[model samples]
Target: MTVIVRDLRPGTPADIEGFIRVRHRALPYVFFSPASVLHGLSLPRPDAHARKLLAVADGEIIGTAQVGLAEDSREPGQGSLNVYVDPARTGRGAGTLLVRTAEEHLAAHGAVKLFAWVLDEPADRAFAERHGYRPSRSAHFLRLDLACAALPPLQDPPPGVELRTAADFADDPRPLFALDAEAGSDEPGDIATEFTDYAAWVDEYWNHPHLDRELTSVAVADGRPVAFSVAHTHDAGRYRTGMTGTARAHRGRGLAKLVKNDSLHRARAAGYTEAYTGNDADNGPMLAINKWFGYEICATEVRHVRELG
Candidate 1:
């Protein structure tokens, strides 16, 4: 059977469904849906330079890759290509084909460095190393049973702090954007990102198809968002923690935990069965918070970097 690699057809329902299928199977800890896939393709960032690719074998998509430049990063020439192959269909060269295609596309678009997230398994790491990618940072996928587990009790905010939903900022998300920009800058990662474009943030994140504003909890102080636990839900009873962070000035106050706990409790109350989130392995503070919530480490992925020059 010949394995063929091609650009994903955004207009085709089958293409989106196949891409989501491979992602869900290869990385069950994360949440993905056709709507989210399409939303990503529709992002308006001129620098995004995003492309979704698929590896097909005998008319079936067995692997997928998301290749794009890190347009949001202040640094130049940084690109990302994350590939996932169906576990049942490995060893057929689909993974190799997808990576080669993605690299070629990125290099042609002036990408000087490429980053990928490889599963922590020996074979996955070996494959990355063989492809000239070196390990850098590691991250963990955490999972919690929202239906059966006992979530931390929702607590009243401190005297000056108030708990609100992301919905409250629907009129003007600039404050939330400011909080996101501050907290995201402090997140542990190889590439540093600064969110300066409010319009882009609104289109790419705030209006994302899966984002559940009602279930997203925010911590407000002095009439400004200090911390938040962004939530995303799928029709299939799955809930994901999109982003959980505390503003720089608000760190160490336990607000991150408080908001996340509230988000989780609300998610369960709204009929979500599973909760999922990912954190940098070195992000000890957030990891400890997740552990406190009884979330178990379900999977790990190591970031791999490859120099284009």
Candidate 2:
């Protein structure tokens, strides 16, 4: 059987479904849907040259790859390509072909460093090494049994702080945008991103199909959002934490944990049975907070980097 790699046709429903299927099969801990896949392809950033590729064998998509440049990063020439093949379809050349296609695309876009995430398994790591990629950092995919696990009791915010839903910022989300920008800038990563485009953020994040405004908890201090936990829910009984962060000034106050707990409790009340989230292995504080919520590490992935001359 000949396996060929090509770009995904986003206009086709079959293509979108196939892409989501491969992703779900390869990384079951994360949430994905056709709408989310389409939204990602429709981002308005001029510099965001992203593409999704598929590996097809006899008209069936068995592998998928997401490739894009780190446009928002202050550092230039950094790109990323994450490839996932169906667990049932490994041992074919799909993974290798997808990687080659993604690397060529990133290099053509002027990427000097290419990064990819490989599951922390012997074969996955060996594949990266065979392709000239070296491990840099690791991350964990955590899952919580929302239906069975007891969530922390919701408490009133401290006297000076108030708990609010992301929906409260409907008329003017600029405050939440500012908070996200600041918190995301401080997030640990190989590429540093600066979120300056309000419109792009709205189209890509606020208006995403899976975003759950009612369950997304935000901590308000005085008048501004000091911390937030963004939630996204799928049609299936699954909820995912899009992001949970605290502003730099509020780091030591446990506001991040408070907001995230509020969000998770709301999600459970709303009938979400399973919850998933991921964190950098180096981020001990957030990891500990997730553990407090009874989340266990379901999978681990190592970031692999390759330099292109």
Collision pairs in model 1: none
Residue 215 of model 1: what lDDT?
96
Candidate 2 clash pair list: none
Worst 10 residues of 2 by lDDT: 40-49
Q: How does each model score on TM-score?
A: 0.98, 0.98
Q: Compared with the true structure, what per-residue lDDT tens digits does model 1 show for residues 121-153?
A: 999999999999999999999999889988888
Stretches off by above 4 angstroms in model 2 are none
lDDT of 2 by residue, 1-309 (tens): 999999889889999999999999999998789888988888875675799999999999999999999888899999999999999999999999999999988888899999999999999999999999999999999999999998888877877999999999999999999999998887788788899989888998899999899999999997999999999999789999989998898889889889998888888888999999999998898899999999999999999999999
